[model samples]
Target: MATDTLNANVLVLNKLWQVVDICSVRRAICLLYLRHAQVVVKEGGAFYTFGFEDWKDFSRNSRGDDFISTINYRLKVPKAIILMLYDRLPPRRVKFTRKNIYLRDNNTCQYCGRKLRTDQLNIDHVIPLSRGGKNTWENVVCSCISCNMRKGNKTLKEAGMRLIRKPRKPDWKTFVKNRFNTSEWESWKDFLDVAYWNVELEEDK
Candidate 1:
């Protein structure tokens, strides 16, 4: 189980310590071998690391479970890695898609402000396509089944509907808030400031 945990996903950090992406254990080990990145060992974890010398002794090492051996080399699966030269920040724009639309709306119907399950939600065009509305982020919203049926082929004013909020492209923070999972990214918490629903904070009282 420990070895499986060791083989779990690894977080990749840029030179500035900002999380840029994730990588597999095999890829992390390759980066370490190529000297492009360094493994990060959490505090109180004995400070072990994967490096060029970890490849020696092949089968003679007693701690084989900590590493993957490739005939002539062996190195521990990386938990997290820091790129030595990757300094660019992540792109500002997020991809546009149905899932993104739901995220932008927080899975709530824009018309009635009702929260519903994903399966019960539908995508609505703020300005009907037949009436000249383009399918861009600024013109689309998450709608409930009832609202969608109620507003079919009609404008909001025409259908006697009001929007809780206007549709617009979400900012980078909001995009990330909807996209990332903190549980799977525990190794990245120290480097990122994203506040997830599952995070625990000190009691104010």
Candidate 2:
């Protein structure tokens, strides 16, 4: 049971309390003991020391031994941790791919403005490659199979088709924000960027 709890997922944060990445509870505990990180107490909203002597003051039943147990001492588990050394936000670079194009277009057909699943969507080159368009982010967008077939190889003007929205490359922030549901990550919610939540991570030092 202790080992299982130690293996649980832990959300890691930068010194500024930004969600940087996730780690195993075991790793989080190690960092706590090593003083590489301190646990953030969400209850009273405080950052608490995780030193060995400090943890020993608390009873096992009060805190829990799964987080730490050695000799006659034990301590509490950390659901979230903040590193002492990191400062900068992680770097983000949006990739060029079919899945990313769907994300950029909000999984909706740009021509008709209807949201659809992956299977129901098609990647259409804004300017067909047959003419002179390259397979670039700006040149492609999400379209339904119907729109793709109707437009065929003709340009929008030629096919009498019009785009409901302009297709553009997704920035790293917006790209990652739309990837998760609004209510899906409660534990990670506060630590994530409020206005622009992206989970891109970089090395601490």
Candidate 3:
């Protein structure tokens, strides 16, 4: 139970009360202890903030399962916290990776347009490497084994194949939208944009 509480997700807000990121409960408590962040709590439709000691005092009378027992007291695990200094969202750049490529392509074969599981997809070079094709966002796409073998080392023209959509660099918002986890804390809904609340997360390779 203690381990579960420590590892639970905690929503992080900027000074401006905007959603910034999600952190672990352990990190949140550490920030609170160091005076770098304050717990943000909601009660009676109003939001409130508390420092580490004040939160500990309040927890004395609180009753819930989300508590960590210390030698002298039990600390309530906060669901959200606000950074005392940070007011900016994280950088908006999306890393180019195999998982992201699959995400961008919706796990569908660019050549055959059939959606498949990750194991069934391969990153195919639109233009073969032997022909001087560079590995880049616009040059690679998800392909099923059959389509990959069919288009092997051949240009689209030679293979009589065409992509369903033209590949381009995806914006950060598009990528983040796909990564939002629907199971995030309910307290986070007050800070998160409506568009982000219902999204799902994908595991990175």
lDDT: the better of candidates 2 and 3? 3
Which clashing pairs does model 1 show? 55-74
Q: Ten-residue segment with the worst summed lDDT in candidate 2?
A: 196-205
Residue 166 lDDT, candidate 2, scale 0-100: 76
> After best superposition, candidate 3 residue 202: deviation in angstroms?
20
lDDT of every model, 2 decimals? 0.71, 0.71, 0.81
**CA lDDT, candidate 1, residue 48:** 38
Q: How many Å off is the CA of 33 in candidate 1?
A: 9.1
> Model 3: what TM-score?
0.59
What is the model-wide C-alpha lDDT for candidate 3?
A: 0.81
Candidates' TM-scores? 0.57, 0.57, 0.59
Candidate 1 runs further than 4 Å off: 2-11, 16-18, 23-36, 39-80, 85-89, 181-205
| Runs with alpha carbons beyond 4 Å of true place in candidate 2 | 1-19, 22-91, 184-205
Candidate 2 lDDT for residue 44:
68
Report the lDDT of model 2 for residue 118.
97
Q: Taking the tens digit of each residue's C-alpha lDDT, what string does model 1 give over 85-128? A: 99987544556788888988889999999999999999999899
TM-score ranking, best first: 3, 2, 1
